[model samples]
Target: MKARASSQSKATLLAQHVRAGKVYRREDLAPYSTSVDRELRQLVDQGALHKLAQGLYYKPKKNVFGEVPPDENELLAAFLKDKNFLSFNPSVYNSLRLGTTQLYNKTVVYNHKRHGEFVLERRRYEFRMKPRFPRPHQVTPEYLLVDMLNNLDDLAEDRGSILAAAQRKLASFDRQKLQKSLEQYGSAATKRLMKRWQTAEQQGSAA
Candidate 1:
């Protein structure tokens, strides 16, 4: 009289939606939300899911890290899933090996609008989500770069390390990528960063 633990059809759908390197949302796992949420909560209660935020979760690391503490980046990334724009941005200052200061908190930004802050484990993510247009890529790389660059100073303590990231971004990024991105997320600042990146590229190439 009880529902089976794992329905063949439902399991297939979950595997289908899960792709390597991509964070998933409830919709992605909705096929089994009824069955899975319960089982999932069981995992969390068992300290398997390691709750990241409300309605967001991820698998534990393969290698043991003693207590299996909450992974802020994973939990934060998962929380930002289904967002208009989200990316992993690590600037020089935050790069511990780069000799810059570190934060007591793990910080992140949500470029798309979703007002208010939410608590995540030991970290408090203070973010302001701004309304944004759709982008071809869920989160364009260039946009991520600029956000890192603009916030580099606040996020990183060492100017040297920040400069290194800036140069690496300048050298590797294709500024024109922003033009195509405008088809999706057209913003004044995105446009501005694109144009600036282009000019710098031109000068760099000429030299």
Candidate 2:
């Protein structure tokens, strides 16, 4: 009877610390319970928390539509345990007006750590390891343009037309910003193409 009371007390303390709509790793709630795994299991059984994956949990919030899905940013932050990752759908390239209109079903995460596909709480993510990628807020049209060319072969669009369109569109972008993005994110092929475009632009200006 004494042990049961103690267990209940621990669970109560842990419950008090949990916030709805927040994703948590097991260690984040360890301080509240001596037997965290036990309490976590209890919480799961009680429907107070949903198990997202091994060592991960979510305190769900409900509305008229039913349970709200976990926020992608919050979910990624908890899974990676780092805020430095850049996450977006390939569909974002469509905004560049470079003739890409495919809607991708997967999200890509560019970070220094973790590579390969993972499904977290029903959302699929392709984590690609990169030595450098812009911060979320720093992502610009120039950056996306360079990235599209870098991943050209992987895209389903007609490469030749896209390349032709890109060349035509290059003159409209700020040269300095485009050059900087190309330097930072462009692949060898993209760099060479951009160099040729820059040379042609310079010659056109001279003429």
Candidate 3:
């Protein structure tokens, strides 16, 4: 893409959006028009804006101290914009830094063009063809953690920190709501994990 004559203000706005850490939807930039977009692309090509994926742009974060730059979840989301993506156990697995040290659980899951097997970032991400996704409310932190208990084998430990971690995470959790959620979605993979974790707790106390 070649540079085009454009308002410098639009370019500044684009940079602001990237600085704010919000993913850009092409439509969001509609106010700026095609010419502005062309300049945005040019900016990306010049290494000013990091092109996360088609139409998704970002500005690189400065690495502070010796800590490596954080894994840009926004970039990952942009990278996987095409697939039916969801933040799942993989995110938790990544947060815990528990799986194969060399691997990144991507760790998100989505239905990608109905392909049974696929690879990204040298990691395997699964896409279920059934095209099922939970409502927005169902993917909360508590629910996701419980869901991870089952979907991620690493989180499901027979005698490890999993119980403690889950318990700690859910300690202040509203029992009534979690119980209700369990009843409603228990058949779900995430819900099943909540059950197993509960079972482990009960069994441990009985011992």
Candidate 4:
């Protein structure tokens, strides 16, 4: 009875910390008690949480439509156990007015851990271990430009037109931030492209 009561008490405390539509891991609940494993299993059986992967779990948030999976931020946080990741739907490029209308079916996650593609809760997430990304969780226009160039070879769009569009929009971006991003995260080829672009823009400005 005492052991059961203690387990229940710890579970209650842990439950208070579990937010709906959020992903968690056993390590995340370690501060509450040492019996987190047992209590987490109990919670899973009780339908309070759903197991995602080996150590990953989610608190399902249901609406009239049915259950919704946690967003990429929540899922990746639990998977990597660190928030050091950048995620974006590659399809976002189509909406960026980047002269590409083709839709992609993958959510790319750039992180220090994991490589290749994974399907979580019916959503495709592709993980690539990157040394640097300009920001976490969201894509900025400047970074998008860098990324588009970095993955240019794999893109289905017309490279010439895209480059022309990027050239036209160069002044619309934050020059310093874009330069810093290029210094940190840009590949050799990407940097070369930027250098040429910057030089051309300088000459154009002078003219």
Using lDDT as the measure, which candidate wins? Answer: 2
What 10-residue stretch in candidate 4 is worst by lDDT?
134-143
Q: What lDDT would candidate 4 get against the real structure?
A: 0.83
What is the clash tally of candidate 2? 0
| Tens-digit lDDT track of model 3 for 1-207 | 233334555575656555533455555566655566666776676666655445655555554552232254554455555534554435444454233123344444544444444453244545453355455456644444444554545433442455465565564666776676555434477665666767876888899
Q: What digit string (tens of lDDT, one per residue) describes model 1 on residues 1-207?
A: 134445544444444544433334555566655577665555556554455566666545443445444454555556765435442334433442334445445344555545465666665566667565334355556555544444545554666665565554565655576456543455565456556756887888899
Q: Decide which is better by TM-score, 1 or 3.
A: 3
Query: Using TM-score as the measure, which candidate wins?
Result: 2
Model 1 off-target regions past 4 Å? Answer: 1-24, 67-77, 82-108, 131-207
Residues 1-207, model 2: lDDT tens digits: 999888877887899999999999999999877799999998998899989878989998899999998898998888888888999999999998989999999999998778999888788999999989999999999999999999899899999989989988988887888889988989899999989988997899999
Candidate 2 clashing pairs, residues 3+ apart or interchain: none
TM-score of each: 0.42, 0.90, 0.44, 0.73
All models: lDDT? 0.53, 0.90, 0.52, 0.83
lDDT of 4 by residue, 15-40 (tens): 88898998888788778777789888
The TM-score that candidate 1 achieves is 0.42
Better of 1 and 4 by lDDT: 4
Candidate 4 stretches greater than 4 Å from native: 1-20, 26-48, 136-139, 201-207
